[model samples]
Each structure stands twice: as C-alpha cells, then as structure tokens.
Target: MKNSTCLLQPSLATTVALPVIYSFLFPAGSIGNILAAWIFSRQALTKRTQYIYLVNLVSANLLICSTMPFLTVYFARGYQWTYNSVPCGIVNYLGTLIMHVNMYVTIMILSSIALSQYATLKKNSDAQYSQAGNENCQRFLLKKFRQPKFAKYLCIIIWLTVLCVTVIAITRNARARTMEESPRCYNIRVEAGELGAMVLATGCFFLSFMMVLLSYYSLTRHLSEIQRNTCIEEKHLIYRTVKRNIFVIQMILTVCFLPYHIFRPIFYVMLTNNDCPRLNYLVEIKNFLTCLAAAKSSLDPVITLLLDKTFKKSLCGLFTRSTSEQHKRNPDIFIEESPDT
Candidate 1:
C-alpha cells in the first residue's frame, strides 16, 4: 500500500496542480504576448534588422502562447495525451517545431543585437571628437550599426535549416512509431530513435547558446575599448544597460531550460532498461522539468513587460484603467522613437 501510494504521488501532484497553474498562466501569457505583438508591430519604426528580429520573436511567443491552453489540459490530465490522434500528432509536431523556432529566433536576435552594439562601439572609438559635432556623424554611426540585409539572409537561412531538421526528425519519428502498438499518440520512450531526437535537439540548443555567448563577449570587449579610449560617458551607460538586459534575458532562458536538457537523457536511459526504482524518481524529476519549460511561455510575457518600456506602459495602463472616467483622464501613451537607423 505504501509503495503504491508513493508511486502515485508524482502523478497526482502533476494532475492536481498543473491545471490551476496553467489556467492562470495561459491567459496571462496570451494577453501579454498579444499586447507585445501589437506594440511591436505598431511602434517599432527602427530600420535596424534587430528590431525585425525582435518582432519575429514576439510573434513566435504569441504562436506558442496560443497553444498553451490545449497543452495545459493535456499535461494536467497526467500525460495521457487525450486529444484525437490527428490533432495530437499535429499538436506534437507544432509544439516541437515552434519551440525550436523560438530558440533559434531568440539566439539570432541576441547575436544581432550584440554585433550591432560592437559595431557602434568600434565606430564611436574611431570617430574624432570634432567629427562627432555634426548630427550627421551620429546618423552615420547608427547606419553603420544597421544590418537589415544580414538579418534578412540570416532569418531565411535559420528557417530553412529548421525546416530541413524538422523534416528529418518527423520522418524518423514516424518510422519509430511504426514499431509501437500505440500508434495514436507520441509516447516518450528510451528507444534509439528517441535518443537520436533528444541528441539533435540538445545539440542545436547548445550550439545556438554558444554563438550568442560569443557574440555577447565580443560586444562587451568592444564596448570596454570604446569606454577606455573615448571617455564618452553616455554611450558607456547605454552599453551597460543593454548588456545588463541581455544578461537577464539569457539567464532566465538558461535557468528555465537547464534541467530538462540535462536530466532527460538519464531518465530515458533508466526507463529503457526496466530500472523501475530509478525510473520512478526520474519520472517525477522529468515532470517537474516539463512544467518548468512550459512555464517559459508564460514567463516570456512578464519578461517583456518588465524589459520593454512600451509594453510595460501598455500593461500598466491596462490594469489601471478600471472605469470610463479613469480612461478619459488618461491619455494614450505613445512609444518614443527607437534609436535605430
């Protein structure tokens, strides 16, 4: 009886708690991402390629958030995958596809932002103080930092790469499914095929993260050089703030995803070998990690509200305007022009 009770605890915990948490998280994330999408679309006037990437990132978050309610219910019911086979297949495919899309999009955006900052810093370092007197010099500096062509090509390459990878993964997944009796749903198993999929996903994540980190490091070094040589305190302040923001965003993503990437393989190995005792504990851990990853979709909105000034103002106004009288008293807050060429 005690062993049965222990065995049931993890499943029960997920079944009971996940729905309530997701109930709140899904709506909040959906609303926030919608607002972010709207704001980015309306106010992001920057000609810089990074803004375009930022917009795409928000759009991807919105897409992910749109699917949260369905996922929330599915997971809350103890991972039974109750949806119809067709819908289940579609959802599973889309969920996996969008996750990778989000990952790559964010990495590209962060890398671009870092590169832009580095270019700006380097140019500022070389510019004569007298040359800086002309406003055109500042405009030229901004133009040098703009990389729309690179951003366009990079985005195309990323989507193409993801498309190819997804096709291969889906083909492998379908082939693996033919061997299973339960053909209606995707099941987590410790088969060689599943292991291959996991390896591919983990490798992609690690590679993207490393690229972003290297770009950030390069940008930081260039900024430091500019500060040391130019003595321009204002640019230094902007650089520090942007760096801090990037650091916070990266930290949030890393913390949310680390457990799943690190522990999932161990769980898979234990399950495949019929190691029941180890599998039990690892299953619980995997459930927790799964919840953590889903929570990122929810958290993305809050992060935007906190980090982006325009979104923050919109959110504040949304909550503060309760009555028509209050609405009349408050004027719409417009986003100030972005500092991009």
Candidate 2:
C-alpha cells in the first residue's frame, strides 16, 4: 500500500485544476439550483408531475454543491486532509454519501422522466385512437405513473433506495488508515467488495441508458403511427420536441458520465495491481473525469430551462419586472423621443 501510494500521487495538474473546477462549480451550481428551487416552489401547488422530478433533481444538485468546498480543500492540498481528522472523515463520508448518490439518483430520475414522457404520449394516443384496451397490471401501473401522487411516491422510493444502497456500500468499504502511508485523503487501494459494488453500479447505468433509448424509440414509433393514421401536421413538431428532450438527457449522460463509468473498472484494476507503471497518469485522468461528472450539477439548470416552459417564463418575467421597476425608479434619466420631439 505504501509503494502504491508513492507511485500514485496526484499530478500537479490534477491538484491545481480540480480545486479550481470545484471552486467554480460550488458557487455556480448553488446559485442555479437555489433559483430553480424558488421557481419550482412557486409552482408546486399546480400538481404538475414533472415538477416532482425537477424538484428532486434540484435538491440533489444542491446537496452535491454543498460538498464542493470540502472537495476543493481536499484537492487543493493535494489530497492531504489532516489524515483521519474529523473534517477529513466528514469529507470522506460525503464523498460516499452525496456525490455517489447524486450520480446514480440523477441517472434513475432522468430515466424516469423519459419513461414518464413516453407514458404521456401513449396515454394521449390511446385516448385519441381508442386502441389501448388495458393489456395487464403493467399497463395499469404505467397509466398510474402519470399521476402526481404516483410521481411523488416514486421520487421518495428513489431517494430512500439510493440512500440505503450507498450507506451499505460505504460501510462495507470503510477501513482505518495506517501510519505507514503518508497522511493522505485518497489512495489507490480497492476493496473487493467495493469493486464489485462499483461494477454493479456501472451495470445499473447501462440499464438506465437502455431505458431512455427504449422510451425514445417507443415515442417515435407511436408518433409515426399517429401521423400515418390521422395525418396531423403537428405530429412533426411533436416528434421534433420529443427528439430534443431525449437528446438533452442523452448528452448529459454521455458527456458527464460515460467516460467515468467506462474508465472506472480499468482504473480499479490498475490501482489494485500496483505493478502498473502508468498508475499516476491514470489517477490524474480519473480525478479529472470525476470532476467532469460533478460538473453536471452546474449544467442541470440549463436542463430545467430547456425542458420546463414555465421555468423559462417565470425567469423571463422576473427579469422583465426588474427592468420595469428600474425604469420606474429612474424616470428622469431616461426619456423616449418621438420624431416630433
């Protein structure tokens, strides 16, 4: 373990860039999510099922953002955090709790959103054409998922399940650091149980990815059927809108997540072997990709703006109102001139 620690010290770039990135992400993500929370809270009483997911996503992002200062401190000091101090333990606990929770919870929630949209499309099509005549309990459950009550319950289930799983995983991986190793916050040791859990988590990601794809495919085919049967010109616009929705989620997962998950098992193997000559290089890449994954918290506000029309309208209205108030307060400084004037 001591030799592996010596060989896998974070590179200069990793130490410098990760702290800066986390510092920026901390403020940006906090402000964005706070604004989102305010906007969503105003509309909470409207019983929009979509708001359930949006609110939960914002909550998770805020939690993740709150952890960034600690993370910045960790990386800024080159992963040396007073070795087994209370703050170090707190940071490590959060790394296991909120960080991992947000990633996997975001995955499941986004997949749920895609599947919900697909359900909405199916319900609308069934209503219009009168073809879906209640196949089974699964069909009934899908229909139920469209309701706000169902969505709220589902969100609770997701949060509880993720929290329980992550807590268990962390407990299983916890160990005491020895004096032989330099007092460092991070090292290249991978427990067998943790590695297996990580592999299982990666498989969940793939399953969620396939769920989104299946939702997109189902929606496209259903829309095509509608166009063929009724020849509605608006179907083209709806198709494009759905495509954009799927594209946004897919882009987030692919850009922020795929690289980390894809590299994780390989990184684990390399770290575990201790004989890998390029371990330090891999460690740098791993840290950078982990930062990239956390970057999604800062990017999620854009997702809310793109997907929620009311969020955009509320934000625009707030800006417009502020401008009008400013103009009213400074009437003497500004004047409109007509050609006659």
Candidate 2: residue 102 Cα off by (Å): 1.9
Scored against the true structure, residue 168 in model 1 reaches a CA lDDT of 79
The candidate maximizing TM-score is: 2
Q: Which stretches of candidate 1 lie over 4 Å from their true place?
A: 1-10, 44-46, 78-91, 94-104, 126-146, 183-187, 190-193, 223-230, 268-272, 310-341
Q: Mind giving the per-residue lDDT tens digits that candidate 1 earns over 204-230?
A: 667656755665676577566656667
lDDT of residue 236 for candidate 1: 59
Which candidate tops lDDT?
A: 2
What lDDT is reached at residue 289 by model 2?
87
Worst 10 residues of 1 by lDDT: 1-10
Q: After superposition, how far is residue 185 of candidate 2 from its true place, in Å?
A: 2.1
Global lDDT for candidate 2? 0.69
* lDDT of predicted model 1: 0.56
lDDT of 2 by residue, 1-341 (tens): 33454434676676787888899999999999999998777653335566677788888888888888878876766356545566656766675356777778888888777766666656656766755545677557557656777778888998899878877756654554433244555555421125666787899898988888877777777777777778667546555665668767877888898998889888777765555447677777877888888889888997777776666766776777644344234311101111110
Clashes (backbone N, CA, C under 3 Å), per candidate, total 0, 0
